[model samples]
Target: MTKHLSTPLANSMGIQDQVSFHRTELAIILSLYGRMVAAGEWRDYGISALKNLAVFSVYRRTAEVPMYRIEKRPKLRLQQGQYSVVGMDGKVLRRGRDLKQVLRVLERKLIRAVD
Candidate 1:
């Protein structure tokens, strides 16, 4: 029989040790989505929580690539800001400490003439 020095449970998240969204952050994101959805500008969305990042992707259609991505990287909380909105072109639309403000860049897309 072979003996291992470390236990199998050394690096893993248990069922209950999962990551979750902050209430304020969720409110900001969902509010934006709600407005976009009501305007028929967004059709679908997805969320991803990885080891070093949390991403919220917005889609114009179910089969196509996401139109936008809202990301949270805690590591950048001190450097270039933790929250960022990335466009479909993989460009950074905005980055800041406040989620609502960073998201304003996306809201700008919804603006149009009232004719």
Candidate 2:
């Protein structure tokens, strides 16, 4: 048996809303992070869960701005897909319904940085 925790949110519609990555999602992201770290392309990362979005920020160093941000916005799912990878310059590198596909953009960057 397993126990799961639930968090209550502040909202007026009498509806509960929680934005966060699932365990499997985190596993996938962490695997990429591990590879980038081993390749010496990434040093630090952060995760944030807001009312409408979940973000994974990657940084070269703790003090620097995130080099990339992977965002998930369920509101955008039907219209334009929920997964997006944004570069430091605030450009959308890729956006799609598949997280692994969107993350491939960063994999290319790792190759470039390593060489």
Candidate 3:
């Protein structure tokens, strides 16, 4: 004879516990990434989908720390907007509700790099 146990952990196993970028959001980020890569300003990138937030980390090299991190926090969507771009030093360079607008900060660098 076997007994079945019901727990909160077990109940959540079937659900997706992590947050991630939507297709349209990824398109916006990747578009910026492609441009940066083409300009030789970025080399590698990483993505992390965590329980509360999703992060897109940009790297100049694989072994080094990420140069920038674009993050999406759904919890902040109502308060301070969900989209944010963080610098290498862990500073919030930009934050807004619109992903494309927030990403413009990085795009400015591309302009500088190209000039």
Candidate 4:
């Protein structure tokens, strides 16, 4: 006798049901990541795609907690804007409808790192 397996809830919902970064969004994030890596201010990173939000986390070391979290929440798109950069302490450094604008907070740190 063969046993039937049930599908996972996520699989049944399909890919579109989850939030994720688009190519253009990744491009922008990567550009900043690359620069930060080269500056030696950031040593590692992680990405997470969840039901309501997507996140790109930057770390100073592989084992350490992420120094920052860049999040995109579609539900917040109509409210507090869709993009945000959160500090290690979980405080929002910046939030805006424009990803570029929201990411400037990190860029400012990069500039300081170089100095």
* Residue pairs of candidate 1 with colliding backbone atoms: none
Report RMSD for candidate 4: 6.8
Worst 10 residues of 4 by lDDT: 6-15
Residue lDDT tens for model 3, 1-115: 9676655675677755689999999999999999999989999999999989999999999999999999999999999999999999999999999999999999888665334
Instruction: Estimate every model's Cα lDDT from 0 to 1.
Output: 0.87, 0.89, 0.93, 0.92
Which residue pairs in model 3 clash with each other? none
**Per-residue lDDT of model 4, residues 3-108, tens digit only:** 7565577567773567999999999999999999998999899999998999999999999999999999999999999999999999999999999999999998
Decide which is better by TM-score, 1 or 4: 4
Q: Considering every candidate listed, which one attains the maximal TM-score?
A: 3
**Order of all candidates by lDDT, from best down to worst?**
3, 4, 2, 1
lDDT of 1 by residue, 56-92 (tens): 9999999999999999988898998999999999999
By summed lDDT, the worst window of 10 consecutive residues in model 2 runs over: 4-13
The sequence of per-residue lDDT tens digits that candidate 2 reaches over residues 43-104 is 99999998899999999999999999999999998999999999999999999999899899
State which candidate, 2 or 3, has the greater lDDT.
Answer: 3
Higher-scoring candidate on lDDT, 1 or 3: 3
Identify the runs in model 4 with alpha carbons over 4 angstroms from their true place.
1-16, 113-115
